[model samples]
Target: IYKHSGELVAKHAFRVASGLDSMVLGETQILGQLKSAVRTAELAGTLGPKLRQLFDASFSVAKFVRTETDVGAHSVSLAAASVKVGERIFGSLSNVNVLFVGAGEMNRICAEYFVSYGIQNISCSNRTLSRAKDLAETLSGDYFPLSDVAHKLEKFDIVLSCTGSPIPVLGKRAIEKAIEARRHKPILLIDLAVPRDIELEASELEDVFLYTVDDLGEIVNDGMRNREGAAREAEKIIVERLVQFKSQLDRKKRIPVIKKFRKRGELIVQIELEKALSSIAKGERPEEVVKVLSRAISNKFMDEPSRALNNDSTGEKLSLSEALERLYGLNKN
Candidate 1:
């Protein structure tokens, strides 16, 4: 009832498009992260049945996208786009030394992408030297102190930054000094952070090519068009899955009614059993007492319904019987 329906719908759409699950089946970071978020909400008691249903539907839709369509085949990711942009600018990423400004997930992904492109001269710098060193060691890149960026910025031809700080991590003046030190060599800088790690003024420099997250939008849009047809097919699968989930939810709504009916039946049995025990205390034989109690209780329960059916002349009892059968899972067919 909290209306998580819209969020669930969007989550389903995103998981299919983001290559979190592709036809080729690569790494599944996005899907795992989404599931973890849902699980956290559930643990916090913030998730209701509606949201739970929606998330379950989203996961099912993601599965359908992976199995039923080729949308994920040759998928283009943000990190891959960074590497592609690097290749486009320098013509060969192998000769370009790469530097990452943060030890976050995005930075790690970009570093991995660069390394995969044979770019061995890589360096990582962070506010915390230990974190930077850890990421550098895993990627086999050199680690630099955050303060060393001023001295070392000129060393790398491709600079990718995504720090969490609100302020710009790389200023125009800092890049200006780095550019002069490199003797006007072309440098491609990618800023994937939201608040923007690289200053916009740096783009005005002659030899520096700076790209923000917004700049990657055009590239991502172009790649998305190629997969539009498959996306449409995946949408159809998602709708079908949602319908099935909703139908199951509707059926679950009948559970309370069934429970109430069973509770009433138990009460009737308990009352009759008490009466039988009282008769046993008055010297009734145990075997005959049990047999008589069973028949008497059965007759007492069914007598009213038998009399009503006999008195009804318009087949109303048949309708009631059908309704009860449907409710209690006693339908003949």
Candidate 2:
């Protein structure tokens, strides 16, 4: 599905989850992720006009929710749950030395949340040291080569791993050595990777706490229910925004008509100006000639738009006029 209509479907999914088409509205993380996903798809050349429109509307709805409702004002996102889990294991994140494996998007987000919790001694290790360094700069942390994980594992009180490796990066024996080096000081490990970064056996060892992405699901579900009422209000805001977006999109379809009108008006102006210039060159008074040319051009320009406005039987012209009025800030009192 992802290969064929993945981009479009993902974009629509974001719209729905963001409350643009949701039962509950203004869920911030989903919308932001949706936008990110859309951008990624666009850059990959997988996004088409249909998907783009849906994603754009979704973004509009998400923005409306942020501005018009309290849905995102007090929301708890998955990132927050990850931080909570870290806090639960360590008690206070203030003094914990943290190392993040992988400089991917999820790792960056988790690092930001950890920094928010007052973790200062943070570092990142990735296969590409440059990528790790780039992410480290954002969090004001240090970077190390991925191979150094074994040597430096004991230094950090917490390890958050999420990389694109097929095999486990941290095995049971390696963690066991790190735990022994720390003299049994507890190490909290949060693995956000899909195929799993830390070996499952590491969780069974004493003084090493491991929480995978699945473990955080419960916390997120609990947090989601707490804001159910706010979500409904957000959904209402999204629906209104979606309707407004559709109206704007429909108005955009009339661009060719507006373009044709402008083109014809310019052509008429050019022909009349040429005539007026020819009359002046043939000994007509310069001031009088200029005045006549100005009036002629003005009349010619206004003629089509005025005619369309007056001879409007169907409401298409009225709708177009209203759209233009709103666009140009022209008020008819």
User: Which candidate number would show the highest lDDT if scored against the true structure?
Assistant: 2
- Cα lDDT for residue 249, model 2? 69
Can you write out model 2's per-residue Cα lDDT over 1-333, one digit (the tens) per residue? 233353445435534556544443344446656678888999999999977877676666666656765555442655777767767777887888999999999899878977876789999999999999999999999999999998889999889899999999999999999999999999988888989999999999999999888887777666666566666776566556656666776788888889997898788888988988899889999899889988998887767767887788768887868867996688956
Give the TM-score of each candidate: 0.49, 0.49
Alpha-carbon error at 248 in model 2, in Å? 34
Error of 1 at 64 (Å): 22
lDDT (0 to 1) per candidate:
0.78, 0.79
The lDDT of model 2 is 0.79
What would the TM-score be for candidate 1 when compared with the true structure? 0.49
